[model samples]
Target: EDKVVQSPLSLVVHEGDTVTLNCSYEVTNFRSLLWYKQEKKAPTFLFMLTSSGIEKKSGRLSSILDKKELSSILNITATQTGDSAIYLCAVAAQGGSEKLVFGKGTKLTVNP
Candidate 1:
């Protein structure tokens, strides 16, 4: 079965601090890896990585994929209390249709 594992299950940081979250996966017929940030409600899309060595960035958030290693990393710069959330990593596999297998997620708490 396809599965994803995220490191440092939880994190605590002060406002303005930077954080890095790691995700590794083992799956067949892999299509892509996606990152999402979840706060009080549903998760919000962060990035989608299909090709290795390519970094996707949006403001203070960025992510990169390493296909050779079957892994990905999410980096958050200048985190604020508003940055506190659960970061989820999911892998899409090619089947009849694309299906996503999600990681447990890394919970980040940015303190003021």
Candidate 2:
């Protein structure tokens, strides 16, 4: 089985604040790392990171992958109430079909 852990399982922050979410994984045959934000419906894809690239950025959100530490972190700047959601970290294996193993996730609540 895959081992994935997320720190600070929950967080509460005010608007304009910054939050850092962490995820560490020890999955055999790891192929890539992925981040997702779940608000209500389905989870929305945020970023996908592979061994070749260690960092990804999209507007006020950025993520980094550390191969040496086998972990990844997501940073959200200028948080807003709309940003409140469950942030999930998943890892895909390198087999024929990608099987994603996900962590419990960190629930972020951005207050006004």
Candidate 3:
């Protein structure tokens, strides 16, 4: 079985504050680690980390993968009200029907 878990299921941060989202997993034949930001309809891709040490970054959001530890972290800097969303983490499996198995996600609220 492949599974993913996220910590601090929810968070409240003030505008301009920084936050870190945590995700840990136990997976079989893990292929990659993916991060998504969800506000309404569906999750939007944030980062996909496959190799260790290298980080994926976009503006105020960044993430890194740790294959050896079977974990990953996402950081949001200078958060704004518009940054409020659910952060999801998933692991990609090799040769699996469900390409990715996801965590319940961490809900973030940035107060302006």
User: How far out, in Å, is residue 81 in model 3?
Assistant: 0.7
Evaluated with TM-score, which candidate comes out highest? 1
- Model 2, 35-64: lDDT tens digits are 999999899999999964457999999999
Predicted candidate 3 versus true structure: per-residue lDDT over 1-112, tens digit per residue: 7889998899999999999999999987888999999999889998898998798889999998888888999999999999999999989988747688999999999998
lDDT of each: 0.96, 0.92, 0.91
Which model scores highest in lDDT? 1
Q: Mark the 10 consecutive residues where model 1 has the least summed lDDT.
A: 92-101
Clash tally, candidates in order: 0, 0, 0
Ranking by TM-score: 1, 3, 2
| Model 1: per-residue Cα lDDT over 1-88, one tens digit each | 8899998899999999999999999998899999999999999999999999999999999999999999999999999999999999
RMSD after Cα superposition, model 3: 0.9
Colliding residue pairs in candidate 1? none
